[model samples]
Structure formats: C-alpha cells, structure tokens
Target chain A: MFGKGRFVGIISSIIAVVVAILVGMVFALISGGNIIDTFKAIYMGSFGTQMGLASTINNAVPLIFTGLAVALPFRAGLFNIGGAGQMYMGAIGAVLIGLYVNLPSVIEIPLAVALGALFGMMWGILPGYLKAKFGVHEVINTIMMNYISIYFVRYLVSNGPLNGVMGTARTVVIHKSAFFPILWNYPIKPVSISIVVAVILCAFYYWLLESTKIGFEIKAVGYNPKAAEYSGISVNKNIITAMALGGIAAGLAGACFTLGEMHFVSNDFPVEMAFTGIAVSLLGRNNPYGVIPAAFLFAALQASNLQLQLFAHVPKDVVNIIQGVVIMFVALDRLITYLLTRRKGGAKGIGNT
Target chain B: MEILNTTLLNQTIVAATPLILASLGGLYSERTGVVNIGLEGMMLAGAFFAVWGDYITGSPWVGVLFAVGIGMGLGLIHAVLTVTFKSDHIISGTAINIFSLGLTGYLLLVLFHTHGSTREPVTQLPYINFTALERIPVVGKFINEVFFNHTPIAYIALGLVILTWFLIYKTPLGLHMRAVGEYPEAADNMGINVNRIKYFGVIMSGALAGMAGAQLSIGVLTQFVQGMSSGRGFIALAAMIFGKWKPFGAMWASLLFGFGTALASNLQGTNVAIPNQFFLMVPFILTMVVLAGIVGKSIPPAADGKPYEKENK
Candidate 1:
C-alpha cells in the first residue's frame, strides 16, 4: 500500500508512535500501573464506543482551529507564539456577540464567528506590523502579548463591562440562541455544528494553500524572503497577511469553544490547550492536511487519560510525557535522514515535511 | 521622607540583585546569538536543586554549587538540542519548560510529600553587616541596607557584571563572542570556533541564572515551591533588551524593574484605590513599552536562532 516515499514517512511516523507509547509505559510503571492494563485503559477510553468516537471529534475540533492557526504563519516562515493570546481574544469577542445580540442563529452565529476572527486578526497583525516595520523578533513580542491578553482578559472579567454581578472573575452565561446546538441524538455523540464548521474551514484552508495566488506568494516568501522580494511578491506584506490570517484561525478556535461547549467565558479555559496545539502542529509537521490526524491522535490520548487514570492509576500528565516523547523523536530528523540515506540513492530529501 | 527613602531604596537594590544576575545570564547567551527562552525552566531547576542540596548538606553555599552544576547540565542539554542537533529553539524551550514542571512536580510528590518544601530557619543565607560601609548616614543607610546586607551571592553578582564588562570588551575571546553573534559566517571565516564559544556563553548563562534561583530559594524565601521563578526569566529578557545588550544597561534596567516591584509590594498595605493586580502589571507593561521602543534599533545577532551548520550553502 505504501511506496518508498510513503514508506519512509509511514515508517518514521510509526517509529514516533512506538517511542511515544514506550514513554507512556515507563511513566505508567513508575506511577505503579501495569503496562498492558494501562494500554487497554487508554484504548478503551479513546475508542471503546460511539461516545468515545464523538468525544474524540469534540476534542479534535478546537485543535483543528489552533493547528491551522499555527500552521498558516509557519508556512509563511513566521512562528505565531501569540496564538494563545489570539484564542483568548477570540473567546472574548464570541462571548460578547453570542450573549448581547438577539438575532436569529442564522445571523447571530456567523456574526459571532466573524467577530472572533476579526479580534484574532487584530491581535496578530500588531506584532506582524512590528516585525515588518521595526524588525523585532515576533517570538519575544508575541510572548509579551500573550501575558497582555491573559491579564487584559482577566481585567475585563473582573472589572470591565463583562464582570458578573457576584464579583467572581467570570462573565454571565451566553444566550442560548447563540449556542451551537448538538447535532446528534446521543448527547455525548461527536456531532456538533462546530465539527461541520471545522471541516468546512479545513476545506477552505486546503484550497487557500493549493489553489490561490496569495498562497503561492506565502510559500515563496517562506522558502526564501530575499528571493520572494526579488520576484516582487511583497515579502513583508505577505508575512503580515499570513500572520493575520493565522491569528484569525486561532481566534475561530476560541469562538468554537465558546459557542459549542462552555457557552460562557471563564478564567479557567485551559491554558494548556493552546500549548497542545503547538505540539499538534509540530507533530503534524505543520501541514494543514496532517493536523486532522495529529489532532485526533492527541484528542484520543486526552480522552483515554480519563480511563487510564481510573483503571491503571496513571497520572493524567502521562499524556504530556507521551507528547514530549513524540516531539523529541520527531525532532531527531538528522537521525531519520541518516537512516533513509542508504534506502534511497541520496536523491530524495528525507525530512522536508 | 527619611523612612521612605531608606525603605524604598533598600527594597529596590534587594529585589534588583536576582534580576541583575538572571539578566546577566541572559546577556551572555544572547550576545553569542542564542535566544534562551529556557531560562525560566533553568531557573526553576536551579531553585529546586538549590533547596534539595541545602536540605541534604545543611550548607547554603553547597546548595549554590548544586544549582550551578544543575544549571550547567540543563544548559548543556539546550546546547546539544538547538546547537548540535538543529532542533527548533522555541520547541526545545517549550519542552524544557514542560519537563521542568513535570520533573519538579514529581520530585515534590516523591521526596517531600508536600507540594511546597520549606527548610528550617537555620540554614538560611546569613545576611551581612556593613558597619564600615554604613557610617555615612542617609545614603549609607540606603547602600548598606539595600546593597550590602544581602547574602554573598549579591556581591558576587555585582562583581560578575564588572567582570563581564571587562571580558566582553577587553579580551580576545570576548571579541570572538561578539563576532559569533553579529556575523557567524565572518567569525567562521576568521577561524574562530563559533560553536564552542556559543556553548561556553550559554552554559555560563545557566550557571549564573542558577545562582539567581539559589538566591531566591535559600537567600530570601528559605523554601522551594513549584513555579517559584514565576515570570522572572521573561522579565530578565526584557531587561536584556531594554539595556540594548549591554551589561551595565541590563544592570540598570534590572534595578529599575526591581524598584518598580519593591514599590508595588510596599503599596499593598496603603489604602490605595487601584487594585494590587494593576500594580503587579506595571513591570510587564513597562517592559512591553520599552521593548517596542528598542524593537528596530536593538540589533539581535544576524544568526540568532538559526542553527549553525558547518558545511551548508
């Protein structure tokens, strides 16, 4: 089923998976759990039934947004570390529009999503502008912005217009009209409108990269900025546009969480979700196509962690250890290159993806 | 007014010492063209190791040594991953942070059986008496209380700044270090070992930053807790940038930020209308503004995060 090119990618991916499993096993043993039972627990938790499948999809939905958010700027050769900040802003925008507005779902939902996207775009564009205009490394600036967004959101929840009457650091529940209703008979099933929306966005993202002139420019700029500039592609403009678009995608992820799941903005919207997205994008080699599978893999691990804890007595951070191992193995591309060199005639690049 | 002058000034220098040490650590790596975002993790490792060493050995000086050794080890890991293996700097740094959290958290569970570990008051870093230095009244009080009364580590940090200033400007190795950051290709062409210098510089940063962490857990708090470094590493990064990659400039910036922290801490008891959280936000906000100002003009080395390959086009 797999040729040499496909074989290499598959074999490498399999190796990554095996290494990850082993890392998980080591942690499970240390935490006083039998390896086989832990493995079974994780399997059951992730894919035991229809409900498990649905939960996996639910987890993958937000990851898709965050993955695309990171992968877009990465394709343009910029690292968007501020996706966490953008996601928070997106949540804020979605919550405001979802709650305060009294339009029909047909109008209200799209408006809320758009507002979230716009909020994300604005957040990303500031650093993009600074990077293009002033030549600041986006990494440092984006990190600072993450704290700003976190604290700013904290300020809004506590003291600004969104503060609850009880004085706790959270906003009022969003209106039911704005909520993304369940799309399946089973309450735990994986059929939210968010998944449908995510699939549509994924199709759009693939099209944006494969079929568009702007996409070509972004790839060109990423490959070599000087060459792109020489070719009159406006390298700086493309960098800015790609980052802004990337930020919008992250924001949309936040909107999905707000509209689909929680239906409210709280201070405890998992900080690690954004970081997990980083892991997903990296594990997927920052490919938009790869994110779907990568996200599912992580979502499965997360879902399974619940059962693993109950049956195997493994700590939930076992998932983090697995993630760490996967990243470490994937990062050893030099080793992968050496391994593949003998198989090929030295003509094929081993780890370009 | 007199009380205000002494207390505020004293707190500023006291707070500034650790920041200055950490920022100096940042300067060493950054000057050699490595973006060391793992500093926070390294500082945490140092903090934990220091306390662990202190508890075992019953000597804070030994704890300081333990921190330096551990910091160097962590720095070596970063060096191998980013410098030798060509991993992404940010990803490697993120892994370090996550691993530190897990490792420290796990250690806490196993070793201490408490989430937070505290030492008996006996093994604390003994504060110094500066009677000879304190003879000059108001100014003397500020200097003695703020600068002199700190543990041995504070004086070491001040001496390090002067030594670093001399090393960077007055030595051949220093010239090579700057060359490696500014133009690695040029340095490579001139037969300088860029990789070795970068490794030395980064490990040096880790050792110094480890001392900063040691100062925090042993000298001030007398305890080790999870997430103890907080955002000090990032703040030190800000100091490095705000200081325009100069040692003295970083020192001054760290001192200023330290003063801001001291003032904010002092105002908590006062009946002020502003929330204490807003005051907490002051140092970070100032860093943003200062960073933006220096964004274009402050030149990072040409090959800052790009991994060095000896034989590439």
Candidate 2:
C-alpha cells in the first residue's frame, strides 16, 4: 500500500500532467487542428513502432542524466541551474580527449568520459565553493556560469584551436574508438550503449542516496542546515559533495550525447536538454526513482512533438506550453491539494499540505 | 575624437535604456521582497506583444501599451502563485519564464504564421532631434548629440531613474513597500497592507519590464525576434544586485553594463585579437565578480525570498 503522503503526491502529479495535456489540446483546437488526431500523432510519434520507441528512449537518456544532476543537488538544498554549462564543459572535455587521445577503445572511451565528468565537477564545485565560503546565492552564480561556459565553448570551437579543418564552427569528428557500441539493432536508429550506462548510473544514484551516510547528511542539511550543523555535520562539505555528484551526472550526460549520438561537438548544438531536466526533476519530485518515469514522459513528448507538427499540423511549440504548464501546476501543488482536500471535506494532517 | 566620443555615448545611452528600465522594474519587486527572476520572461512577453500590437494596429504607442498590459498580466500570475498560494518564489519564477517562452512562440506561430521571428517591420517609436540645440556652441552640441535623437523611451528611462530614486527614498507608499520587504510582520503590525504593497510592487515591475521590452522591439529593432530580450533581463537583475538594491545604484550599474555592451560592439569593429564572443562574456563575468562581493557586499532585502503566512505571525 502507498503511504498517504506519497499517494497524494502521485495523484497530484498525474492530475497536473493530464491538465497540461488538456491545455495542449485546447491550443490545438484553436489552431484549427483536430484534437484527436493531434493526440494520435503524439502516440504514434513516440510508441507506434519499435524505432519510434527506441528514439523516445534515446531522447530520455540525456534527460535521465540531467534529471539526476538536478535531483542530487536538490537533496542538498541547492539548485544547480548551471547543468547546461556543466554539460557543455563535459562535452568539450570529452571531445578534447576523444579527438586527441589515440588509444584502445577501452582506455579511450572511459578516459574521455571521466574527463567529461571531471570538467562538469569543476563547474558545479565553483558555485558550491562560492556559496559555502561567501554566502553567495548559487542560483545567480550558476546562471552566470552558464553564459560564461556557453560563450567560452563557442569561442573555442569557432575561432580557437579546437576549430574543425572543414571550415565549420565545430571540432573534428571524434575518434571511432571512443564511440559507444550499439546495444540494440533497431532499423532506424541504433540504440547506443549509453542507455545501459544511464540505467546503471541511476541505480548507483538510488543506492548512494538511499543507503549511505553521506546521503543522510545531504538530506539532513537540505531539510535544515542549522539542525544539521548542530548534529555535527559539515554543511559546506555536504554541499560541495552533492554539487560535484550532480555535475558528474551532467558531465556523463554530455559524454553520452557526444559519444553515442553527436560524434562531434559543434557551436550550434542545443543546450535546452539541460533546461528540460529542470521540468523532469520537478515532475519527479526530486526523487531518484521518480526521475526515470518523469524523464521518459518528457522524452516521449519531445520525440512526438515533431510528428504532431508534421502529421496533425499542430505547432511543436505546444509541447513547450504543456511542459511549462505542468511545471507551473506542480509548483502550485499546495493549491491543488487544498482544493482537493476542501472538496473532500478536509483530509486531516496530510504532511506538507 | 569628438565624433567617436559622441557615437560611443549615444550607443551607451541607447543600450542602457532597456537595462535601466528593467533594473528599475527589478528594484521595485525586490524592494517589496519578491524575487522576480521571471523578468526575462515578462520582458519577452512584452517584446512579443509590442510587435503584435504594432503589427495589428499600425501604431507603436498602442504596441507599447499592449506590451505593458501583457507584462502586468504575467506579473499577476506570479503574484497569485507566490503571494496567495505561498509557493516558492524561485520555482514560480522559473515556471513563468518557461511559460512565457512557450506561450510567446505559440502565439507567434498562430498570429503571424512565422517561425523564429516576426517578418513584418513594426512602426518605430519617434525620436526628438533637438535641431535648435544643434545650432548652439560646444554645450549645445554636447546636449544635442548626447541627450537627444533617440527614442522617447530612452528619455523616459532616464527620467524614471530619478523618479524611482525619489519615490523609493521619499514617498510614504515606498516606505511601506520597503518595510514589507524588510519585515512583513512589522509592516503588518504598523497597519500596512503587506499583500497589497507586494502586489503593487510586483505589478509595477511587470509594467516597467514591459516597457523595456517595447523599447527593444519597436524602439530599437522595429521588429520582434524570438528570444529578443536575450539576457538583458538577467543583466538587469545583476545590476539591481550590484546596486545593492538601490534605485540610483541600480541605474549606475545599468550604465556600466551598457557601456560594456557598447565597448564590445565597438571593439568587434576594431582589429582586436580576441574573438567577439569573449567581449560578449564581459557582462556576465562582471556580474559574477560583483555577486562575489569583490566590488562590495551587495546584500539583498532582509526578508527576501521568504513566503509570509498569517499563521506564522
């Protein structure tokens, strides 16, 4: 049986998602599109065939990592909005190693991935250090870092030594030895082994958070820094550790994207995947286990959005509207709970409501 | 030499107009203790609506009004979520930003049948030439060149800087708003309507940000591009913080950033070895340095980012 508190959270999340979809449907109707066809397009785009499903899962791969990146820091009462920047740094680090290091597949792939994680960890730790040492707010710092990382990467690829020889604002194609092998032989898109890595990482994240003393310290600090300090925990240390862990996940996401799909780094590469992770973490309630399904849902929507646009003549921007509304509703979870409880003649002593 | 200085000064003022307006907007919200991170989204909404209004009505002034109205509507949503529901300000802000981007993009496709940007040119806001001033000597030349020949919003932005300083420091309503930000319970005890003051502060921010957006679309570019606000709203937030949440201080900070932007564009024209992107990074890097308190301790409001509840009292 589900705990009453968890049951309420799950029910509210479900309602929020359904409400968002309905809102999207209304938008479709106004645009003179058939609502049923739009819905059908979304379903067909995400799950109509094995290839569609594979692509949907492939899209989820980055979301899962970015979700973990956000969720881990949230557990320590920190918002890691710099995931985009950290992911970029990770990608650049991986690309540098992938293009330069001419080694065996086993050594090169793991090294590139580790370097990516290390770079991401560096980005995450800077803000954490600033917050711990100077009382600087991480939100502003992380946002600032995001722009810095973006511009820096652009400069490197566009005009610096990393520029490709082919007159494009991108690095040279990464070595084939660094490529992640195909896990499944799907006709349309080969499912990269990065999906397996992501699942393993998710399992590790769950184990680390649920069964470790550091995890307890992180949650305790997140709950109340003052109380955690009184209990002899180093709040600063936990903050740094949690941020580094989050960065590591984000960095791995960058590596996965580079080695598994992109195969090279370019200036025009999309960084919005990191932003979608915010929605994912929110929908997941910042829980490691919850992030999987949350990421999957978001990924499916993203994968299907194009099909909806092409087949149903619905604007793909509707997906953005749905995602935005879902986050808004989730943020207003207290209001939803109040309305629901009031309608039910009051539920007594529901936690955090 | 005089021509270069005049051009630089002109560019600086033109660039600073939006920043000053947006920062002043941020100042009001922060002064009333609401962290308005959604200024970016609100400004984007304003920019889009300004173009839409201009495109439909064929008048820039009407477009500016539309932008302000839409911006305030977004502000109202933020007020309800944060003030009424007692939601986290940051979460509400992030949601508002995400919502604005999506909603604006959706509206653009529906109304204009365009992607990425509106193709139609909006009616540009008129400028004051001050031709009489140009006929005078050195002083008049300075005045004509530096203080005139820009959109009316630039003048309005300058005037608002002084007005904001006076209002926040001298007015009774401003006192109540500041008191609410510092300590809502204390303001409540003093018979101030805390919620009303906060709402007004946030809504005023939205209006100003909307104007800033209008300045960008109709006043500067005469067309609305997707994500046209760029990171100016965020830069304004940094200016607000760099100014230590003071109106005059924020204006000066805005000017500094405006100067940085002007310098960046100017340098890009020169044979500088550094890439254009590095110059673009200057504002963001400076923001980080300022936030790190190397410039000074840029402390925020006392009760900032906290949701007030009557039961807690």
Candidate 3:
C-alpha cells in the first residue's frame, strides 16, 4: 500500500496543504492580522475546549456526508455537482415528514431519513438519466438542478404549506421523537448521535467500494468507461447508481442537519456545505476513509472561523481562500510530485509526457 | 399587453449584455478546445476589480481596464495549469471559481471593512444618448428604446459578437483555432503551435469575461456585491452550448435568457399567481432542457476539454 507512488502522493498532499496554509497566513498578514494569534485562535476555537470539540464534530457531520456525496460519484467518473440540490431536496423531504408525521420514535425517525434519501435519490437520478440517455453533461445539468432545488425549497418554506406561523421562511420544529438523540452529552449543547451514523456510513461506503461487485464496476468505469464497456461492465448503469448513491449520502446530510442539528429547515440554510464538500473530497483524495480526517480538518477550520474573525481580525472568507488555494494545489499534485521526484534524481515524471 | 412594454425590452437588453459577452468569451476558449468553467470566477474577479478600480481612480473606464487585466491574469493561471501542466480542465476551472470567490470576499472585508457587499457605489459607466437618433422617424423610437441610450459597453458587446463571428469564420487565425480545436494532431502536423493557440484562446476568454464583469459592476449596478455574478457565468455557459458554439447563436440564446430574466423580474412586481422563485428557475430549467437535447442536439467541439500533446521528433 505504501509504494513509491503512494508515498509520493501522500507527501505531495501534505506539502500542498502546508503551502496553502502558509499562503493563507501571508494573506492574513497582508490584511493586518497577527499570524500567531490567528493560528492560535483557529487551534483553540476548534479543539481547545469541550465546547469547541463538540462544535467541530457537529460541523464535521454534514461535511462527511457531503464528502461521500462527491466521492461516490467521483469513483464512477461523474462530477455530481448536484449535491447542494440533492441536499436541499432531502432537507425539504425530511422537514415535511418531520413536521407532519406522528409515530413512535423508532418508526418516524427511520421513515424521515428514508424519505430524505429517496428524495435526494430522485433528484440525483434525473441528471444521471439525462446523461445516460441524451449525453447531457452532468456538470451543467447538476448546476441547473442546484438553482431549481434551492428556489423550490425557498418557495416551499417561504410561501408553500410548510411555511412557519412565526412569519419566518422556515418550517415548524420537528417532533421530539424524530430528533437524533445525543450520543454523548459532555455539557456542550448535546452532541448528536448523527456523528455515529456518519461514521457507520463512511465504513459502509468503504466496504461498498472495496468489496461489492457494483463498486468494482463503478471504479472500473471511473478508470476508463470505454475499457469498462469493452470488459462487459454497463457504464451507463454504473453512472446512474453512482450518482444515486451520492445523492443518498447528500440527502442523509440534509436529514442530519434538520433532524439532528438545526431541528428545522430554513430558506437561508447554509448551502456552502455542498461546495465545501468538494474541497474535502479532493483533499481526501476521494477515499472514504480519507474523507473522515479531511472532514475533521475542514470542520476544525470552520469551527475556528468565528474565533479567527473575532480574535485575529481575519475574516471568515479567508478560510474560503485557503480552501481554494488547497484545491488548486491538489489539482497540481502531479506537478509538485514531478518536481520533487526530479530533484531526487528520478527522471521519470508522473502522468502525461 | 404591458408585458411586452418597452421597459421590459430595455431590461432584457441590459440583462443580455453580460451573457453575450461571457458566452462569446467562452466561445473563443472552447473553439480552441479549452472548457472554461472558470468564466464565472473570472467575471467575479472582474466585477470586484472594476468596482475597486473605479473607487480608487474615479474613472469607470479605468476600472473596466483593471477588471480586464485581472481577468487576463486569471486566464493565464488557468492556461498554465490546463495547457502547460496538463491538469484536469474542470478541476482547474472549479479551483478558479472557488479561488476568486474567496479572494474577492476576503479583499472586500480588508479593503472596504464590510462583509456581504460594498455598499458605496463607484462611478457608473457613461450611457451613450443618441439625441439625433431619438428624433428620427418611427424607427428611431424603436432604436432609442432598444439599442440607444445605454452604456457604451453594451454596444461594444454587440459589436464584439459580430467581430467574433467574422473572426472565427473568415480569418486565417480563426481557421487555425478551429483546426486546433477540431484536431490538434492535424494542426500540429501542419506546424501550427497548438499550445500557443490554446493559450491565446483561454487568455482571450479571460479578457472578454473580465469586460463582462465590468459591465455588471459599473454598467448595471455600479457597486460590487459578493457573488454579484451570481449564476450568470453558468447561464452564459449554457448560452454558449445553446447557441451551438457559434457567436450569433450564442447572442440569440443569451437574448432569450435575458428575456427570461427580465420577465421574471417583471412578473415579481405584477400580481403573478406563481411564486417568484419559479420565475427565477426558468433560465436554469431551460438550460437543462436544452442540454437534454430536447430542443436539438448541441454537440461540443470534438477536441474540447482534451489536452494537446506534441509528438517527439
């Protein structure tokens, strides 16, 4: 597993991340911020206290789900930019079910989750079907779908039947039984059991991609769809399945956000999570196991953002810049490794002549 | 009957200007086989710089130049990654989008000491009022309402569309770009510098997209709001595809989207029974339907998104 190429990949990723952070620090300095204070604020805000740790884990839950959403489609050579839309649809579904359904905790919770996943699956499959049948590019279709879903949900909460009585563009609070229970309450606003679900899903994703036949086909398709088609794999089926699975993950993220953390769906719910998932998935190299750590790192950064803004005088938007730079560096991973290898007297470069 | 009012037509023209500019920019790069998903980011950078330049220099034209320069800089970065380093085009473009989003927002806070938007308006781009043309016969009313009495950039955008059409179909340079896009190996065999053409195409896209951003900031709004480009970049991409990658086709498609936007805004004020959100979704839905090939098949260039490689001598 630790071959020369894998080792090089790991090293280059580390270098990329470190370089990005340093670049962010330089920007902070230019913006009249003290680098040491900013770093400290970020560190303390994420993991320094029990409250900070809980917030970090809470923030990480949705990221892991969205990361898997991007990763699964990536495994099948699909971009799946519809995670935001899928998540929004999933949230709407969950909110509707959570608001109306009256059942025992055991039944209602699972039902809402399933509905969320199903709604997201439907949204995901539309683009997949379009791509499979009409050769429509998923990137454009997914983006369009995102705007449609966002606006649709906005309409649902703002003016539709589910609109709250408080004059806010939100749904009513979910039933208590439907809420995700606090797995561990260390005095920090009750850490939800959703994190445990996220972990299990991550494990299941790893198993699916590693052991299952469908997973093998998805990976094969991702590697080379033409080759996979020649080898008897149904590339189209894999594309649909991969996207549907990704949608399921994103849908679950929405469900967790509504049922576990926020307990309500609002029009202004953070849609940036879907975009951040792209950064996390790329940083994790799209590996399910790798996403856990990557999600944690990003979650920590996010958890610290407010503190960074308050104490270090750095705007939260700087984190976006850092994430962007990290992604750019990740895209140039091969070049970085090539330079490193060339300096080490290995004449052969990685990828493209 | 008022739905077809001159005000709506004027609004449509205003909305279409940026889409035409950005789509045409996308057309140039895509013609040379480079998929530019970063047009949105380039536009955002342009919007930010346009406002910033106007704020500092007190000249909207200078701000437009600043936006174009910054846009070219971003395009150079994209070209280096996609053309020279042979990075994945989509990933590089996505990075550009994300980078610009973060960089612009961060700068907004640092420079303006505000978040979400720069509330202060910069000098607006000057509108060209043709008084003589407005006094002409019946045609003058149509011309004055639809085309005249607008910022000079709008006229430039319309002219650029025609220029782009002529350049791509009539000129030797256009033929070489098409050759590079359609068959890089063939172009390479004929001694055409594939990388140079790709670079020029992408850089030119950046410049055009930058000007589009300037049009948005100075011509339309006169202030830079975070994510002010909104989905216009993506819409422009759709317009490019809907137009079948032709300059005139993209202009028509852009005009259609602009009409959709204008209609949506118009409906929001009237007693339209449907939710305004649905109106906001019309352009995106239309884009998806177009991409689904329901209207017609919109195929991209054969070599589009593929990196060119030179053979060893």
True contacts kept of each: 0.16, 0.55, 0.70
Highest DockQ: which candidate?
Answer: 3
The sequence of per-residue lDDT tens digits that candidate 3 reaches over residues B33-119 is 999999999999999999999999999999999999999999999999888877778778888999899999999998898988898
1 against 2, candidate with superior lDDT: 2
User: Candidate 3: lDDT of A40?
Assistant: 91
Question: For model 1, what is the alpha-carbon lDDT of residue B56?
Answer: 86
Question: Tens digit of lDDT per residue, candidate 2, span A58-92?
Answer: 99999999989988988888888888999999999
Show pairs that collide, candidate 2. Answer: none
Off by over 4 Å in 2: A339-353, B1-4, B294-296
lDDT of 1 at B21: 88
Please tell me which predicted candidate would have the highest lDDT against the true structure: 3
**How much DockQ does model 3 earn?**
0.60
Name the 10 consecutive residues with the lowest summed lDDT in model 3 chain A. Answer: A344-353
lDDT (Cα, tens digit) per residue for candidate 1, span B12-115:
87788888988999888978887787787788888888888888889998889988988888788777777776666666666666666656665554556564
Residues A1-353 of candidate 3: C-alpha lDDT, one tens digit per residue: 55686577667668768988998898888887897899899889999977779889998999999999988998888887788999998898887788998899899999999999999899999998888888877888888999999999988888987898657898889899889888778674578888998999999999999999989999998888889999999989998999999999999999888988898999998888888888888788777887898899889999999899889988888888888888788778768877877753242222110
Docking quality of model 1: it rates as acceptable
How far is each candidate from the true structure, as Cα RMSD in Å? 3.5, 2.5, 2.3
Q: Worst ten-residue run, lDDT, model 2 chain B?
A: B1-10
Q: Which residue pairs clash in candidate 1? A: none
Ten contiguous residues with the weakest lDDT in model 1 chain A: A344-353
